[model samples]
Target chain A: MQKQENLSKNQKIILDLIEKSSGPLKAYSILFNVKKQGIKAPLQVYRALDKLIEIGKIHKIESRNAFVACKNSNCQVSKATAFSICENCEDVTEVSNLKLSKYLSNFADKSGMKYNKYNLEFFGLCKNCKK
Target chain B: MQKQENLSKNQKIILDLIEKSSGPLKAYSILFNVKKQGIKAPLQVYRALDKLIEIGKIHKIESRNAFVACKNSNCQVSKATAFSICENCEDVTEVSNLKLSKYLSNFADKSGMKYNKYNLEFFGLCKNCKK
Candidate 1:
């Protein structure tokens, strides 16, 4: 887990916007939302996003090309992140199961290849969508 | 597993190109490679890719924004796809493990969210890169 300190102005602005959002925000959308706050360019937003992802303050929902604040308070680094995404509602929820994380952290394939970083995205209808 | 039959001309051409590649191929790159074969526009490649992915003939490496042929022969549908990616070398390998697939397919999070579809990508140094 990396410590969150000495963040740049743009990083802070972008992270604050992502953290405030209830759903994931794409890079372009983040740029659009932060334009009033002096963040004007797409490259600026992307740079801030790269930094935020590097420090584990935010995570990219790769499947959706969207970014979300790191909801897992226990891990500040992005080593074992998992999300449950709703197919119908498009809601993404980070799963904070210690047991599941532990199991995945130690998991290896039949070829004896061990991985230190893994991202798992599960898709299903949420309870509300299921009804 | 869905049967691979009655594929459109573009779908077959795109799938063939992906299957021939040693690494994942991005959509634009696929378009570039297949330009001579009458696939001119990006949308043409994207539509073929969407169809291929829908039928489980290819899998998208979301982290890389690339597509690769489905290397797991046991399953023709994209219900349980997993890949181990080398962070240093950028090589991706599909992992075919029955136990791992079964465990994940039946896994439920702490909040009782059961997912029927999952795509897991593991990142680490490969054997060559570790040397």
Candidate 2:
């Protein structure tokens, strides 16, 4: 596991907002929420987001262009990620299945390419939404 | 297999541009390329992209915010997708491994949320980039 580093003021502020949210948060939305803290620019939010993502503090739901807090403390770096997204409710959950992560981490292709990172997203209806 | 539907003028023009490219194309880039062909607005390009994606004619590399032509004819819909992306050269290829696809397709999570779709992207150094 990578050692946790101290976050700057802006990163901490933005990350706190995302971490507090029930679902993923978008860049603009993050900026809007953090403006009271003087993080007014989109670039500030993006820089914070990029840093947070690099340190495995959060993962981006690429399909939705939003960010969610990383639930697994074992993931010190955001290299291999999998999420289960509810299509109806837009609820996003970080999947912590050992078998799935292991299978994907060890996966290789015939392209002769050395895979170092991967992201997988599964879409479905949540229990509540399915009811 | 789902029957192929006829593409409108805008759709055909945009699809042709994306197909002729070696790598995935972004929305703005697609709009720029098709401007001479009368696709002057961003909405036009997005509409065409949405339709192309719906029919499995193209798949979006969400991480990169680009679209690539689907090589597998068996994928009549954009429900399941997997891609191998070269981090160094940004080269992207659609992975057609049957076993991998089947494994992912049949994968059931403990969430009890029936997954109907998934997208996976593997990042690595391509053959040429490794040299």
The candidate maximizing DockQ is 2
Flag regions of model 1 displaced more than 4 Å: A1-4, B1-5
Q: Write model 2 residue lDDT over A1-131, tens digit each, in one string.
A: 22335998898888788888999999999998999999989999999999999989999999999999999977778999999999999999898889998999899878888899999999999888988
lDDT of each: 0.88, 0.91
Clashing pairs counted in every model: 0, 0
lDDT (10s digit) by residue, model 2, range B1-131: 85457898999998888889999999999988888888799999999999999999999999999999989977789989999999998999999888888999999878888899999999999999989
Local error of candidate 2 at B99, Å? 1.1
Q: Which lDDT tens digits does candidate 1 get at residues A43-106?
A: 9999999988888888889999999999977567788899999988788999888777887888
Q: Where is the poorest 10-residue window by lDDT in model 1 chain A? A: A107-116
- Lowest lDDT 10-residue stretch of candidate 2 chain A: A1-10
